[model samples]
Target chain A: MSNQMFHTSKSFDQDLTETTDLFLEMGALAGQQVAQAMHALIEGDMHLAHQVVEQDSAVNQLEVLIDERILLLVAKRQPAARDLRYVMAVSKGVVDIERIGDEAAKIAHMAQQVAADNSGTYSYHEVQHLSNQVRLMLHSALAAFEHLQVERAFDVMRSDGNVDFEYQSAMRALMTYVMEDPRQVSHVINLMWILRALERIGDHARNIAELVIYISSGTDVRHSDFETVQQAIDASKIG
Target chain B: MSNQMFHTSKSFDQDLTETTDLFLEMGALAGQQVAQAMHALIEGDMHLAHQVVEQDSAVNQLEVLIDERILLLVAKRQPAARDLRYVMAVSKGVVDIERIGDEAAKIAHMAQQVAADNSGTYSYHEVQHLSNQVRLMLHSALAAFEHLQVERAFDVMRSDGNVDFEYQSAMRALMTYVMEDPRQVSHVINLMWILRALERIGDHARNIAELVIYISSGTDVRHSDFETVQQAIDASKIG
Candidate 1:
C-alpha cells in the first residue's frame, strides 16, 4: 500500500510539472502576440493588425483555460506552501498576460485608426522607438519568468520607469505639436492613445516580473523599494 | 479517536471562519475609506483628504496581514475544493481592496490640489454627483460580496456603464470650461483628473463584483455579454 501511494504521489507531481510547462508555453505565445502587434503598428500593416486582434481571442481563451486548470489543481490536490503559491502565481500571471493581450489589441485598433486617417503628416519614428523598448522589456520579463531569473525580472521592473519617462515626454511633445498645429490634433491624439496603450503594456509586463519574483522568492515585494526587493531576492537565494 | 478527530477538524474550520471574517472587516473599512475620500473631494475638505491619505497605510497593513494569514491557512490546513476557492477569492479580494484604497488616495491628493488653488471658478457639483453614484455602487458591491448576492452584484456591474457615461460627460464639460476660459484650465484639468480617478474607482468596484460572482458561481463572467452574465447568475440562484 505504501508503494502504491508513493507511485500515485509521483504521478501527481509529474502532472503539476506538466501544467507548469503548459503555462510557460501559453506565456510565450502571448508575448509573441504582443510583439507582433507592435510590429504591425510600426510597419503600418493592417493585415497584421487584424491578425493580432484575432489572436487576442485565443489568448483570452487560454487565460480561462489556465485559470480553470489551476482552480481544479488547488481543489483536488490541496496544494500547500510553495506549491500553493506557485498555483496562485500562475493564476495571476495569466491575468497579467491577458491584460497584455488587451493592450496589444488596443494598439492594433489604434493602428487601424491611424491607417484610416491617411494623414501621412505625423512621423512614426518616436512611436516606433517606444514600441521597441516596451517589446524588449516584455520579452525579457517573460524570459526571466521561464528561467526564474530574479535579477532579470528586477531589470524588467526598472525598465518600466524608462518607458513611463519616454511616454511622458511623448505626451508633452504631442501636446505641443497639437497646440501649435490644431489641424494635426486628431492624428496626434490617436498616436498618443497608442503610446499610452504601449506604456500600459509595459506596466503589465512589470507586474508579471513582480509575480515572477514573488513566486521564486516567496516574498511580497510589491510596492517595496527597488533596493529592498533586490535584497529580499538575494536573501531568498541564500536561505 | 473519532471524536478527537472531529474536535480537531471543527477547530480548524472555526479558525478559517474567523480569518475570513477578519478579511471581510478589512474590506469594509477599505470601502468606507474610499467613500470618505470621495466625500472629501466634493466637500473640498483638505483635512479630510489628509486623513484619508494617512489611513491608507492602515489599509496596506491589512492587506499584508490578510495575505500572510491566508498563506498560513493554506500551509496548515490543506483545504480543498470550495474551501480553496474561498481562500483564493479572499486573497484576490484583498488586493482589489488595496487598489481601491490607492484610488481613494489619488482622489484625495487631487482634492488637495484643488483646495490649494482655492479657485471657486469650477464648481465640484458634477464630480460630486458622479462620486456619489460610484460610492453607492462600491458600497452595494461590497454588500453583495458579504451576502453573496449575485443579483446585486450584477446590478453593480450594470451601474458601471452609467458611471462611465457620467465621467465622459464630465470630461467634455471640463474641456469646454477650459476652452472657454484658459485661465481656469489648470484647475479644470485637475478636476478632470479627479473625475478620471473616481471613474477608475467605479471600474475597480465592478471588477470586485465580477470576482465575487466568479467565486460564487465558479463561472468566468469577465468579457461575457451582460445578458449572459445575468443569465448565469440567475441560473446559479435557481439551481
Candidate 2:
C-alpha cells in the first residue's frame, strides 16, 4: 500500500477510536446516573435525586455530540463492511445509552414523589436489589462494548431473566401492600414505576449487548431467542 | 451535471424512495396492530388479539429489511447533507415503528389475560379513548414523515399532552376501582399495563415526529420543550 493510503487509514482508525471513547463516556455517565438515582431512592435523598435529574442533560449532550461525530465519520470515511457495521452499532448503542439516562431520570422523579408522599420509611427491599442487578447489567454491557467482548455481552443477556424474575416478585410483593392498605396505593404505585424503570434500564442494557453481538458477528440478533443469538455468535467465531 | 452523474443521482433517489416506502409500510402495519389490539381488548375478541400478536413478526421483518437497505445506501451512495439526514431518520424511524409493534403485542397479551380472568365487560372506556388518540397520533406522525411536513409533526407533539392527561385520568379511575373492590386488583393491574403500553406507543410516535423535524430542519428536537422545538421549526422554515 502507498504511504498516503496508510496515513489515511491510520487517521480513520483514530477517528473511530475517538468516537468509541465518546460513546463509552456517555455510557459511563448513564450508568452513574442510574446508580445515583437508585441510591437516592433507597436512602430518600432528595438532593441526590435532583442531582441525577440535572445531570441527565449532560448525557443528552453527549448523545447529540456522539451522533454528530458518527455522521461526520460516515460521510467522510464511508467505511465499508465491518467498519460500517461497527459504526452503525455504535450509533444505535449511543441511543440506548441515552435512553438509559432517561430512565434513570424517570426513576429519580418517581423517587422524589415517593419521598414527598411517604413520611414513613419506605421498606421496598426488592426495588433496591433489582436496581443493583440492573446496574450490574448496564456496567457489564458497557464493558462489553468498550472491550468488544461478546462473552461479557452474553453475560448481560443471561442476567436479564433474573432481573425480570425479580421484577415480577417485587410487583407481587407491592401488590400485597396495596391490597392490604388501599391508602398506600399511590405510594406503592410510585415504587412500582421505579421498578418498571429499572426493568426498562435492564432492557436498554440488553439492547446494547445485542449491538455488541451485531458488531462482532454481523448478525441482527434483535427479536431473536437466546439460543439463536448464541448459535450465531458461535458460528461467527468458528468462521 | 453529466449524463453518468445524473444517472447515478437518479438511482440513488430511487433507492431512498424505496427505503422510505418500506418504512411507511412498516409504520402502517404497526398502527393497524395497535388498533386491532385495542379493538380486541375492548370487544374481547381473543382471535383478533392473537392475530395482532402473530402479525408483529412482519413488522420486525420490515425493520430488519429496512436496516439492511439503509446500511447499503449509506455505504454505497455515501449520502451527505439533507439526504444523509433523511436516511438516518428513516433508519431510526423504523426502529420506533417496530417498537410500536412490540408495544401492541404486549397490549394484546394483556388483553388475552384480561379475557381469561374476567367474564364481565372490561369497562375501560378511558383506555379506548386513549387508544384512539394514540392511533391518530401514530397516523399523523407517519403522514408527517411521508410528506415531510413539520406542521403535522407539531400536531402530534401537541396531542401527546392529551394522551398523558388521559393516561393519568385512567390510572386514577382504575385506582378507585381497586380501592373499592380489592378483588379486582389483578384485573385493574392488567388494565393499567395496557394503559401504560398505549402511553408508550404515543411516546414512540412522538419520537418519530421528532425525527421528522430533525430531517426537515436539521435540528435535534429531542429532550426539548414544545416551545423550543416550535421555535427551531419556525427558524428552519424562515431559513
Candidate 3:
C-alpha cells in the first residue's frame, strides 16, 4: 500500500480503539454506580445514595460524548462489513450501559425513600444477594465485550436466568411480608421497585452480552431462545 | 452538479426515505400492540392477550430489519452532519419502539395471569386511565417523530409528567386493596406489574420524543429537565 493509504488505515484503527476504550469507560462507571446504589440501599446510607444520584450525570455525559465519537467515526471512516458491525454494536452497547446507569439512579432514589421511612424495615438479604448476582453479570458482560469472548458472553446470558429466579423468590418473600403485616404494603412496594430495577439491569447486561456475540460472530441472537442462541454460537464456532 | 452526482444524491435520499418509512411502520405496529394489550387487560380477553404475545415476534423482526437497513445506509451513503444525525436518531428510535413492544407483551402476560385467577379482581378503572394516557403519549411521540415537529415532541415530553402522576395514584389505589385485604396481595402485585409496564411504555415514548427533538434541532434534550429542554428548544427557534 502507498504511504498515505497506510497512514489513513492506521489512524482509523486508532480511532476505533479510542472509541471502544471510551465505551468501556462508560460501562465501568455504570457498574460502579450500581454497586454504590446497592451498598446505599443495604446500609441505608443516605449520603451515598445522594452521591449515586448525582454521579449519574457523569454517565449521561459519557453517553453523549461516545455518541458523538461514533457518529464522527462513521462519518470519517465509513467502515464496511465487520468494521461497521463493530461500530454499530458499540453504539447499541452504549445505550444499554447508559440505561444501566439510569436504573442505578432509580435504585438510589428508592434507597433515599426507604431510608427516610424507618417503618419500612424489611430483610435486605435477598436484595443484597440478587444485586450481587446482577453486578457480576454486568461486570462479566463488559469483560466479554472488551475481549470478544463469546463463551463468557454466553455465561452472562445463562446467569440472567438465575437473576430472574432470584427476583421471583425475592418477590415472593416480599409478598409474604405484606401478608404478615398488611401495613407494610407501601414499604414492600418500594422494595419491589428496587428489585424490578435490578432485574432490568440484568436484562441490559444480557443485551450487552448478546451484542458481544453479535460483534464476534455476526449472528443476531436477540429475540432467540437460549437453545437457539447456543446453537448459533456453536455453529459459528465450527464454521 | 454533474448529472451523475445529482443522480447519486437523489438515490441516497430515496434510500433514507425508505429506511425511515420502515421505521415508522414499526412504530405504528408497536403503538397498536400497546393499545391491544390494554384492551386485553381491561376486557380480560384471553384470545386477544395471547395474540399480543404471539405478535411481538413481528415487532422484533422489524427491529432486526431496521438495524440492517441503517447499517447499510451508513456504510453506503456515509451520511454526515444533519444527515448523520437523522440516521442515528432513527436507529435509536427503533430500540425504544421495540421496547414498547416488549412492554406490551409483558402487560399481555400479566393479563393472562389476572384472567386465570378470577378472584383477584380489583378496580381496573385507574389502570385503564393510565393505559390510555400512556398510549396517547406513545402515539403522539411517533407522530412528532414522523413529522419532525419539535412542538409536538415537546408536548409528548410534557405529558410524561402526567403519566408519572397517574402511575403513582394507581400504585396508591392498589396499596389500598392490599391493605384492606392482605389476601389480595398476589392479585394486587399482578396489577402493579401491568401498571409498571404501562409507565415504562410512557418512558420509552418520551425517549422517542427526545430523539425527534434531537433530529430536528440538532440539540439533544435527553437527561435534561423539562424546563431546560423547553428553554433549549425555544432558544433554537429564536437562533
User: Best by DockQ, which number?
Assistant: 3
Give me candidate 1's TM-score against the actual structure: 0.84
List residue ranges in candidate 2 displaced over 4 A: A1-8, A119-122, B1-8, B119-122
Q: Evaluate all candidate structures by whole-model CA lDDT and list the values in order.
A: 0.77, 0.87, 0.87
- Best-fitting candidate, measured by lDDT? 3
By summed lDDT, which 10 consecutive residues of candidate 2 chain A come out lowest? A1-10
lDDT by residue for model 2 over A1-239, one digit each (tens)?
Answer: 11111235888988888888898899999999999998888888999999999999999999888888888898888888778888888888887898899999999998898888874344868888998899999999988888788878988998999999999999988988777776677677788889999999999999999988887888888878889889988987997
Error of 3 at A26 (Å): 1.2
- Candidate 3 lDDT, B96-196, residue by residue in tens: 99999999999999989898977785888888999889889988998887778889999999999999999998888888778888778878989999998
Candidate 3: C-alpha lDDT: 0.87
- DockQ of each model vs. true complex: 0.32, 0.53, 0.62
How well is each residue in A1-239 modelled by candidate 3, as lDDT tens digits?
A: 11111234888988888888898899999999999999998888999999999999999999988888888898888888777888899888888999999999999999998888777868888888889999999999988888888899999999999999999999988988888888787789889999999999999999999998887677888888888888878877897
Candidate 2: fraction of native contacts reproduced = 0.41
Standalone chain B TM-score for every prediction = 0.90, 0.95, 0.94
Candidate 1 recovers a fraction of native contacts equal to 0.26
TM-score of chain A of each: 0.91, 0.94, 0.94
User: Number of clashing residue pairs in every model?
Assistant: 0, 0, 0
Kindly report the root-mean-square deviation of model 3 from the true structure over all alpha carbons. Answer: 3.9
